[model samples]
Target: MANLQESNHQENWENLSQKTNDSLIRVRKVLTLSRIILIVFLVLLVFLFLPWRQTIPGRGTVTALRPQDRPQTVQNQIGGRIERWYVSEGQEVKKGDTILLISEISQPYFDPELPQRLQEQLQAKQSSEAAARQKMRATEAQMSALDRGLNYQLISAENKVKQSINYVKSDSADLEAVRQFYKISQQRLERYEQGYKDGLFSLTDIETRRLNVQNDNAKLIAQENKLNTSRQSLLNAQIELDNIRVKYQESVAKAQSDMGTAISGQATAQGDIAKLRNEIANIDFRLGLYVVRAPQDGYVIKTLKAGIGENIKEGESVATLQPKEPLVAAEIYVDAMDVPLIGDRSEVRLQFEGWPSVQFSGWPSVAVGTFAGRVFSIDRVSSPNGSYRVLVKQMVPVPAADEPWPVQLRQGSGVYGRVILNSVPIWYEIWRQLNGFPPSLEREPKGDGEKAK
Candidate 1:
């Protein structure tokens, strides 16, 4: 029984060996295919380790770099009615060249000779103002003469008053002397009469004494009257002096009042003259505005107002202008998330509209029909689309077939652009993209003026 069992086990082992050999032989193709796949994976990994230049793509319109170089509208400061059109649309105009001739429709400047009329008014008022000044001066002179005349009269009146006072004093002394003489004569007469009564004096001597007394009394009375007349004269002299002063003061006051009136008239005339001058100047300026001229050298693109007799309001748009020789640039908008990676003076490659181009963002050196540019400015705030605007100017010449961008590129044309950033390993970039991570900066950005050249 042991010998039989050993024989079966040996047969089973032989069968198992045969099956194992066959399985090994048949799986060779599968093992070869696995080895080929591993080699291919390793090659792909090596390629991923290469450097890749990161870029942010954007789309925008071609525009001028400077605001003044962009398209603009021409208008007048004052309102008017169009009388004639000097140039039509698409006409090339030099600065100060007349494009339209307008007439003043506003009532204030309706007169064709408005400036001349205002000038005449100004001259008339100026002449009036001059006459008033002359009158004012004459009034002042009159006032001075009145003062001198009044002073002279006051001096003369004072002298007369002094003379009257002296006369009054002399007359008083004479009256007193006359009274003394009369008293003495009366005493002598009384003594004579007593003597005559006693038959000791003659009648003729008494009569003579009486006559002397009468004459003395008459003289005294006359002297008293003279004294009263002198006192009255003194009073009259003083009154005359006071009246002269009052009269002269009134004259001076009247003269001063006349001068004031003349000055007021002169001021009014001067104000009117100034107003007329200003109006004349305004009319002159408005006359120039009647001929609407080009503000700068440009081409008239479109007329905002049409036809003769069309009324235009102040500061209304007259026509559109496109300045000659604009500094061409690309106005691009990029995602807000990608704006932080872009810095001033960053390198940009642009493909303008209507221009055939091939681009490789990671390999800019291999690009075709694209021009090199630099970031000139970036908007601080995001746009309505949650993107930021970036202004890109050509730093290098655009090798277009005919001319450069400044000459050949038209404003408002579409453009596609790529802003270049840091260079990183392709493997890392792929990983970041796969994991949804933001791009990294390999180095610090340049200063605003550092790479200006």
Candidate 2:
């Protein structure tokens, strides 16, 4: 009995008992239990000094690694009525596989031969544009011909002007000579008449001199008329030269105006052709939209616009598709306080929904049925729930202890994730937890430390 109570304080509890051995032996177990508790506490305090891995736990969803690999909506690019369904929910389809058929719901795409008609319109406009171009070429040729003719006529007119100037100069010289002769004749006649009056010469000589003067006067008058004619000819030649230029300008201007008109017509036709071609292309694209096809290899999840003849608006979802064979990931959300402690290469332990797992959040090495992963992405901003999102990708060359993820692991399934961080003393972890502090990083993670440096 004493052996059982040996660890207890003998003076305190034993003295309180009677000196009777029977009462002492049958004493309460209060001091024994207190001693046991104290010993256990001491052992616990020593254990708290041991090293422990820090971790942050979060809830998340199972999803694809890439956004394109994720489940997505199948939509129609144009408004239409569901005519037929080529696929049903849960059916597998390949990329470009037709899922449903839709008929035109709007008035614009009603005509079955609409694209052909547009093509015909485009063809006609193209023909008109061609004709306009040909007319423009004809006008240009006409302008060139007019220019050539103007060059020839201008050269001829210039030569005529030079000839007229030369003729005027010759006529002026002849007129001056005639005036000198008339002057000499007049002086001779005056001298003869005076001698005849003074009886120095016979009346016959005076009469002959007077006749010579009249003759010289007549010649002078003719020469003056000739000079005037030459000047008039020069003036007429200049006027003709100007007329040629004006006439050529008129012809060239008419040609230029015609060419401009043809160009305007060609431009208008080309614009119309472009409009028709654009319409054709758009209609072709819209025609393709009538057959709703799967954008990727996937399974049809659900029909968004159900039933035949149901009207759907442009860009409306027709069905949902879950892509096949996606690279799956665990996406978890952690509190803002804990996000800073996460590292890009942080190890992740995932508990996928519908899968059995025995997890120790603080110690992931002994965990069972939980797959391993590493940080792949993390959102800079908080989620709607005020938690930061972190994406964890599957670990490559997986640990021999970890089993492969189940093939049946589907997207949007629930996941519980634990992001393993740096190791620290258990006491520090306890103190941190007690103080609501973030996980400790006794040493920064390899990747994070390098980044910090």
Candidate 3:
């Protein structure tokens, strides 16, 4: 019984000792965790409470590769097989340089027979206009002649009327003189007859006086008739003069109307000629569609892969022209969080993966030194890669009169960029005050540096 009790006591003591050691180990681990927690809390407190640099900060520089501005690509609204290439790939070109010629069917004139027909029509109109002018001139001349003749005739008729009036006056005077003679003769004859009858005069004397009286009466009657006829003739002459004057005016009015008609005809002819000329010019413009020239001076990136006699639809792209003057820029992506911090006038440092540490100093790096400039654009939308894109422009260096940037840089070169953001806002500093935690921390549980059991 004693041995049994001793053994039981010993087992109890071993169990108690094991429990004490475990308690010690647990205390040591608790202290170590407390110290670690204290250290982390101190670090976080320093960061959250620390004062930082301050200013109205603004600057973001992206690692800039040799940036290339997009090349100018020549496109066509009307497409056809390339008839001829005026320039070869990588050839230097200027503004308004003719690059390629496309062919469909070129019509120099709108109408199939327009040139000849227009020529004939123009000739006809010219001849007609000339004739109209000539006719107008002739009519005017005739009108002038008629006006002069009418004036002469009017004057002549007036003179004739005046002469007839004088004739009438002279006839009236003769008639009056005849009547006076007749009256005197009649009185003498009567006296003679009475004397003869009363035997105071001879019979022969009375007969002779009677004969004189009859002859004088006949002369007076004839003179009166002539005077009446002369008055009637004067009236007729005046009527003729008035009628001639009216007819002359009518002639002049008719001539003026004819001249107006000729002028109208000539104007109509001119309008027709202008219309035809416009049609021909339109045809020329249409024919120009068969020729495709570079829209701007650029490199030919995509060439026409069409064979001879290949059909191309209208507005189809036959080739892409990357403008030589404006270099193509690498489109670099940026993160969203970095975007707002990137202020305007952000500088970018670019490094080409293909070429690095090369001499890109001064303005010697780009062609058309004037076209090369600084970053001017940033993409408003994010890419699928969750980043924003921006365009970096290089200051183009003036070529050394002999060397250029290989007919301007080609398109789609991979580039690396580092955006430099300067003077981070007080907001970011305030975020530092929040222990680098997102503003949504209140909505989520704190990690407390441990896993949940």
Candidate 4:
């Protein structure tokens, strides 16, 4: 019995030793696995804090900053056949310079005698006016002469009246003398008759005295009649002078009226001539419209229709002119997925098509052959190409020596740009992508000083 118990205890001790060795091996394996997993977790944690830049890439074309101002279209102002082109494509021009000449199609078909007839009519009117003026002058001169003659006639008539008055006075004086003589002769005859009766004189002497008295009486009567006729003549002369003055005034008034009519006719003719001349001037102005002139100073970017003899309608586009001092801009189309990542005034890096350098936009310091720019606008709607439009303007262009890029970039050149977004770690990017969530910032990114760490 003692030998059996001792055997069982020895067996229990061997089993316990085996169990201990198995437990030690299992613990060793667990420690080795734990150390490996801890190392891997530490490495992943380190990667999560590493700084990385997020960028959205887009394609664009370089264009003028105000694209609407460029590519101006020149249109024809009138409909006609182009006679000649004074300027060619890509030519620079100044304001008011003649650019082309157009010819009216209906010019040759119009009546050639129209202008000549107008001119002839104008000349005829002018001549008629001249003749009317001459007639007016002649009439005025005749009026002046008539006025002078009338004045002289009036003076002469007045003098004739004075002479007639003097003649009447002289006749009255003679009549009085004759009457006194007849009275004396008659008295002497009567006394002789009385003496004869008293035997102092003969019959023949008395008869002679009577005859003398009768003759004296006849002379007195004749003198009285003559005096009356002279007075009547004076009255007639005064009436004739008054009539002459009235006639002179009437004649002068008639002459003045005729001269006024002539002057009026001359004025009408002159007005007609002026109107015809104005019409001719208007025709000349209309003819001047065949020449086309530049409205502003610019360069002709292209000619839509420059061939001679081509007919163009009014207001049709003839050419395009690009104004000087055009501004530059980048018209980019960003992917819809990346549109939310950009905003106004966001930093951008551009790479021109012909430039030979690689650009790592996430790490801009490692980039070459790229120009710096900023986002100026973000479209609220998608473009026709199923992408959002973003407008970018270049900062002060760096010199080619400073950055291996062109100092002057042409308009309409192809370009590629990257819109710099928030800075994050590569692990976060992987996590967000795996979760199917849009990119976002965990916290506000630090400045350059913190990012360098």
Return the top candidate by TM-score: 2
TM-score of each: 0.74, 0.86, 0.53, 0.48
In order, what lDDT does every prediction score?
A: 0.87, 0.89, 0.65, 0.82
* Winning model by lDDT: 2
Candidate 2 per-residue lDDT over residues 352-414, each given as its tens digit:
989898998667787888898899988999989899999998878776777777889889899
Candidate 2 global lDDT: 0.89
Candidates, ranked, lDDT: 2, 1, 4, 3
Off by over 4 Å in 4: 1-48, 106-289, 294-298, 396-408, 433-436, 441-453
Model 1 agreement with the true structure over 310-341: per-residue lDDT tens digits: 89998999999999887878999999889888
Model 2: colliding residue pairs: none
**Candidate 4, residues 37-104: lDDT per residue as tens digits?**
99999998997887667778889887777755456787776678999998888899987788889887
Per-residue lDDT of candidate 3, residues 1-453 (tens digit): 999999999999999999999999999999999999999988887665543332121122323243233443566656566666676656766557776676653334335665567677777877887888888888889888998899799999999999999999999899989999999998898888788888889988888888898999899989989998999999999999989988988998898899898888878877877887776676568667777777665566656555556656777666666555454454566667656655455444455444433322222223122222235577888778777777765535522342322332434555555543322334456765478432221211335223210
**Which sequence of candidate numbers ranks them by TM-score, best first?**
2, 1, 3, 4
Model 3, stretches more than 4 Å misplaced?
1-36, 49-100, 104-124, 165-228, 272-289, 303-305, 310-317, 327-453
- Runs of candidate 2 exceeding 4 Å displacement: 1-42, 444-453
